[model samples]
Target: MKMKLIDRFGKRLLYGSVLTALSAVLSVYVYAQDGKAGIQEANDKVRGYFSVGCDLMYAVGAILGLIGAVRVYQKWSNGHPDTGSTAAAWFGSCVFLVIVATVLRSFFGIQQ
Candidate 1:
């Protein structure tokens, strides 16, 4: 007796779906953990690394300041008409970076 190919395929598909659903349901009970614990762990990790993040921001700001200084000097020496605007933009960016870092740390109450 030859089994129909389509019937065999459908039976296999049904078996696979049942197995997948069973495994997923079992896993949910096997790996259940406290949500609050997970959230607290994440909070601790972020707080631990916050100071490093702030330091990196400060370093970036310092580098930008130096680059801006050199660029402004070049523009001034070359008598570029947009020198003033360029300088203002670069200065504002550096200040913004420092301010953001400070504000975030304060807002999050993360202390060094």
Candidate 2:
């Protein structure tokens, strides 16, 4: 059975939204932990490690998200199949969420 265009778009959007939410949560958690650490002996013991890790993660995620967004847009505009576009959208959403969460946590001093 062939799927309708609306159905395909809806599915992709749903997947993308879910991924983005999860990423955002992860980012928030990471940021909060890092903030709590602050600059201290414990922070030194951790070697200020998570911050660097989070930064890298965010960078990678951002790149992926950008790529995914582009792919999704192209597919949608051209009326292509949903599979690839859906995957791309999901990836993009997750990355976007992660970046947003990280930024929020950093800005709000939520990090350890």
Candidate 2: C-alpha RMSD after superposition = 21.5
Q: Report the number of the highest-TM-score candidate.
A: 1
Error of 1 at 5 (Å): 4.4
Stretches off by above 4 angstroms in model 1 are 1-32
Assess every candidate by TM-score.
0.77, 0.39
Candidate 2 collision pairs: 33-112, 34-112, 35-111, 35-112, 36-111, 36-112, 37-112, 38-112
**Which sections of candidate 2 miss by over 4 Å?**
1-47, 83-112
Give one digit per residue, the lDDT tens place, for model 1 in 1-111: 256988898899999999999999989867666767878889999999999999999999999999999999999999999999999999999999999999999999988
- Candidate 2: 10-residue stretch with minimal lDDT: 39-48
Clashing pairs in 1: none
lDDT of 1 at 3: 66
Give residue 65's lDDT in candidate 2 (0 to 100): 70
